[model samples]
Target chain A: MVTVHSTSPHFKANARRALGDEQLQRALTNVPGGFIAKRQHAKDKLPEFDALRDEARDLKNHTLAHLDVYLEEYEARVIASGGHVHWCETPDEACRTVIDICKAHDARTVTKGKSMVTEEIHLNAAMQAAGIQPVETDLGEYIIQLRGETPSHIIAPAVHLNKDQIEADFRATHTHLPADRQLEEGAQLVNEARQILRQKYIDADVGITGANFLVAETGTSIIVTNEGNGDLTQSLPKAHIVMATIEKIVPTLEDASTILRLLGRNGTGQEFTSYTTFSTGPRRADDPDGPDEYHVVILDNGRTGMIGSDFQDMLRCIRCGACLNHCPVYQAVGGHAYGWVYPGPMGSVLTPSLIGVDQAGHLPNASTFCGRCEEVCPMRIPLPKMMRHWREREFERHLSPVTVRYGIGAWAFMAKRPKLYRLATGIAARLLKLWAGKTGRLEALAGAGGWTRHRDLPAPQGPTFMAQWKRRRP
Target chain B: MSAREAIFARLRHQLAAGSSEQDRRETASARIAGHAANLIPARAQIDHGAQVKLFIDQAEAVQATVKTLASHDDVPDEVTAYLRKHNLPQAIRHGTDAQLSGLDWHGRAPSLTVSHGPADPHDEASLSHAVAGVAETGTLILTSGPDNPTTLNFLPENHIVVVRAADITGTYEDVWQTIRATYGERQMPRTVNMITGPSRTGDIEQRIELGAHGPRRLHIIIIEN
Candidate 1:
């Protein structure tokens, strides 16, 4: 029902297209400059911020270690609270389960909160195929949905769009409204969206939302949002469905709080989101207004494979998009270049695991390894190290291109004999110095066209670092 | 095998040092029942008076307006004044909480028309009584019941919440402890909303705009006396 043109295999071509996209480049300029200062300010205000991150990491580690037991406990608690849990091994099964639930409710229209898990499974397209309208309530998501595009950024789904592009999209889609309605500013666009989505929320038969955390203690699903769309989507509908991965479950409220401290500060630089709603189950007997039925669809979709593997640490990701915010590679090319639901350093490590290494080989190779993504990650996920692991896998599987393999092979062949390696590098450095003349940089180079296409490669000043180190020390 | 059983089996199989099923269950049960508090921020460990001040400061820091009154009797007049000052409609909506119902809105603001129950699209303002306020981040914890219907929290242009000074605590952990005592062990209200500020979104090129789908303005009334 859903189409995924994974350009991850064509990462080079995708990156080139992204570089040429002026609008995307304009949108991407906001990331490195915008998020860094805000995160720093939030971190600086709290002295115990780093300590909380450590606690968060430890809690996730502990939870993952006993995932099966914790999940069993969580399922029991959910059932006790009058909610049903549907375990889905794959995306197709998850989609089928959701459709069955919708059919059971006789739902014509389904409203949704911003959920990356749903995006992972392409829920919107599937719902549409089933003759159900899936209305994205998040302003960002709604905009992207209107454009029929996947999210470029995790938190900000429409981060790649500019105000003008949005204005045009609104004009093109919202034909019922006055075509000349002013939408010059972000405020105007927001107001227009609010007016449009308000009626949809009330008319919706079922509401689907993603949980930031699923509490095993009380069987509560928590969603943190700056806009209250998630609340409106769930509260007004007849049935509420939570689409979450199995890894989202946590032990207690205290643990949830510990992670909350890191999530808000790192993700949006808020002490707390405007609204953090914890929903346990269907509306109670005393409740005046709420959904009558509650259901949770827990999808595995290759996450179980991540457990006990070297990539298991990835399960700790809370989907804050902090790595995307801080990743230089992500900032340069934007998220769409990575060509999947996730993008950036975390995506580089995760895409291979979810889709396959052969498909997402370019993701790991795309990183500069400056280590900013890992430094900024609230869960302390060793992202660069994981990317290296992926690269190793790609090479071991012979997924790397013949040219790259042969280049590495030739280098390795010489490197094993220290004298031969030193001689090769020494000669190359001297030849490059001679070719440089006064400019001291190569504007063009044969066989290294990819490197020279954008910017000049700096000429080597002297022998390689190994030669210099040996001469100085020996 | 069912998806659930198969997934669980795969997980246990992959675990490096898989414990007995009983051991795993006990560990999970102990953690849940214990509800142990981890490292709380030193900032939240403060005296009551300081906690109140910190609450106000934190709330204001997030663009939420704060006003203090001596008692609940002053609430209706304050709400009327806020609506008039902002040049908004004098119409408001609220839930049937005793704390809110006890306020003499008919006597105080006769011109202001107030409705009860869940919110609709046309609502200009709505009010509720918070179960507790967290000082650590200036968050108001509102439990869903007949007292305060969850819909009033959203679907309005302006949202006003009245919080008793005594109910405001130093951290979210304190609020959780209070919830346990109020709702009984392991039972929570249908929904517990922790609201720090009015609705906002930064989805448009990462620039924040207030009142995306909820109240544009959030005014908190702290009863200090």
Candidate 2:
């Protein structure tokens, strides 16, 4: 079961706490060599990857624009295929709908595929509270679930846990099994999980999975996974439930195909995942095997408010997880530090909107705006621009601290007037130079405790880049 | 209720507080058109042999096995030779393509117990063929046909896929167009499986595993000119 961390006063504190975590820090340090390197290799092979991304972005934009039409079409197709569609306005309604269905079906055990929407709604805990067992079948999710922790990464849910920690967790949890087993190896851990989950898949009364894309024309839910566990989860169960956000809808299978091409290449640098399964409906009478019933619960949960707004581009997200994989903040602190189901560039923009700005205002401010996220985004979401919009909203509502507001206001005032900006920058440089002494680095600063806590803050150079450029031109 | 009525009701409710109806309609229509245009390529064609060769090159580059067979009759012999060469056990569950039915599998490989189609997780090897091979991404599109079940491509240790010289396409768009033309607007096939190479993931410690959850080894047999 997934637990929602108490994020009200302690999110930043927890993130700072996480920064001190040696194990998490070691795991996160591998992101650059892992996702970034693989992506570069994949991109190097496909010179037309950027062109494909542009096309995919355009496609997503087009789909979001006509989302209503496509959603209706998709709903029609789903109904025609004998699947029930439930529209939910909030996370509570979505969770209630799922619970009601499970109750109606007399379901006790629900085997789940990895679903971000389920995470968003906090479904597993709710199900367990209702006296039902919702087992997360994805290896990573299962590991985290056993640990009673939420996912710390989008793609790899247990990214924060080292092999030793996992080994310990397994040993503690699987007391029936032999202790002192060689659980340090990755494959051995995978095999151990496979043995445990294989039984859950067969015995599951109900199966639930998230849709990567919902094709309105075909009324199909497209699930792309390297593991075929998703297919097993859906196929072997008596009932299958797809919990997807309303924004996941695309117009047709063809459109889904275009997005599929982008999904793997961006997420994990694969040409295609091992299993890109498309399930249209419950089992046909003639069909050898499949679920007897299927339900697709489309959760709105403040997304409609975002539509046609500056943040509307966020709905185009395919959940390829490129942003999380490449994000410096996420790479440093991991997902739990963000204190939400969604994390990284997309999460920073989204979590605040869904949960309310007051609760999650710090998310948007956690970025350096380095543009690497925007550079790697498959849908080409103007993430920094959206983040700035959130910042502006936060400021307008007086959510930002008074000191930050005054400092930013002063900076903005100086920036508007070039002369004042130059003078202010000159004075700041002089002050920094005086503070620096003969050496260029400052070990600590009086007001900048947050900046100095992690690493050294470099002292300002002789002049700004703008001033240097002007001097060179003149 | 009619799909149109349901859609309109939902739209009206969603846009009740904000945005004009005309604006919403225009935006919706434009978005639909754009998504459709992106999906439907103007020029989508099937380029057979060259595309197949490209797929083979990609599979080989990823450290997978690639071979060619002269005809369907050569399949059982080829299978036996491959198993023997790899030093695999003789008692293996054989998943055969529908085209292979023409060949006398019982007479050739008497000891082999053949499962006509599909494969269970316990199976050692699953053999099938490509419906269309896309050159752009080096992907093999394997739809659920009479001879091929989608499970065979996934639920096994080793996947041996057969690709005819005639069924290769240049791009994904080309493959989609073919699929549309083949299936029309009727009830489509239950599944359309696309396999690129061997199943892989680098999630744990950034180390790439050949088979994380699906087939560990992917062997391609291209029947060429």
Supply the TM-score of chain A against the true chain A for every candidate structure: 0.97, 0.95
Highest lDDT among the candidates is held by which one?
1
Q: What are the per-residue Cα lDDT tens digits for candidate 1 across B104-213? A: 98999999998888887788889999988999999999999888899989978899999999998999999899999988877788999999988999998788899999
Clashing pairs in 1: none
Q: What lDDT tens digits, residue by residue, belong to model 1 across residues A229-285?
A: 999999999999999998998999999999998898999887788999999989999
Over 4 Å off, model 2: A1-9, A412-425, A453-456, A461-474, B1-47, B83-97, B116-122, B145-147
TM-score of B-chain for each predicted structure, in order: 0.97, 0.76
Candidate 1: misplaced stretches above 4 Å? A1-5, A471-474
Root-mean-square deviation of every model? 1.5, 3.7
Q: In CAPRI terms, where does candidate 2 land?
A: acceptable
Residue A259 accuracy (lDDT) in model 1: 94
**TM-score of model 1 (CA atoms):** 0.98
